[model samples]
Target: MESLIAAVREQDEAARFLVWPGDFDLDRGDHVEEVHLASGATLEGFAGDGAGGTYFFCGEGGEERPILYADSEGGAAPVAIGLPELLRLLLVVPWWRDCQAFTAEESRELAAEYLEDMPDLPARRDRAAAALGIDLPAQADVLARLREVAVRMGEDFVLVLTPEGHPYEPLFTN
Candidate 1:
């Protein structure tokens, strides 16, 4: 956990976006006790929240840790495993969300434009890919793969949280 936190802190892009609760002195035992009391589950680690949801690590020690997503409404669901895998999933979420509203070509163009706007995107991409044990491809290839993952994971998997509501209700319910 310390290594993961250190890595996230070293990356400028990650440090700007990933909000680890411990970084804010909110990962104390009292906080975990409160969570356990409120919900029957224990909090292994507080990863971060974005797009109107919080990501957390939950599992007993000596077991495989699963990453869980808690929506703004207090609903929770498992999303991925470990911090590195969760970070990888997060990197492609925007691309997945954009694909829903745009055509393939438009999505690709938009992804490229978005990456172009982020000066440190390449480094971030490299970090995420290395963590996930996957290769980061060109913009077009990335868009294609994002679409493929969305299709494979289903519509509910690529939920987009809007200001008015949480789109992850269906995911949580199931």
Candidate 2:
């Protein structure tokens, strides 16, 4: 399964790709949406660049999840698609002006840290922005946008709780 995702990522020529398994089958939209809702997220499609060929849609549970068939070809393997990188690609790319440039781990750490400290979603987002060194007044919108991206990325954003009920880390691995 990892190999398959690796193959996709190894291509490295896709302009944009989504990692949602539910987005693949139009019929399963509701099911995926239900799962997303249960996880406190909503599923929606975001536009991607026309270049770089295809958009890879990796589904839940790593390579076991259905990979979306794209009109074009080329992209990182599903497994290789780092959560932070994926979030940056999906959420930040659209808001290029307010987004910060950071590696996947940095993004994940910042987002997690902000969420942990702030607890409140809005406040957490503000901290996220500050952590990223952004001063956009529209931080609320960015938070909402990031939430949508998190839901879309599913397992990647599933926070694991410690014995004391604190978010210890993301549940899934890339």
TM-score of each: 0.48, 0.21
Please, what is the whole-model Cα lDDT of each candidate in the order they appear? Answer: 0.45, 0.31
- The positional error of residue 57 in candidate 2, measured at the CA in angstroms, is 13
lDDT of 2 by residue, 33-125 (tens): 111212333222222233322223443443223222112221111211333333333333332212233234444555465457535544433
What CA root-mean-square deviation does each model show from the true structure?
8.0, 17.0
lDDT of 1: 0.45
lDDT of 1 by residue, 52-72 (tens): 445555646422455555445
Candidate 2: which stretches are off by over 4 Å? 1-4, 8-60, 64-147, 151-158, 168-174
Q: How many backbone clashes does candidate 1 have?
A: 0
Clashing pairs in 2: 5-77, 5-78, 8-76, 8-77, 9-76, 9-77, 21-59
Q: Which regions of candidate 1 fall more than 4 Å away from where they truly are?
A: 17-39, 50-52, 62-64, 94-113, 116-120, 127-174
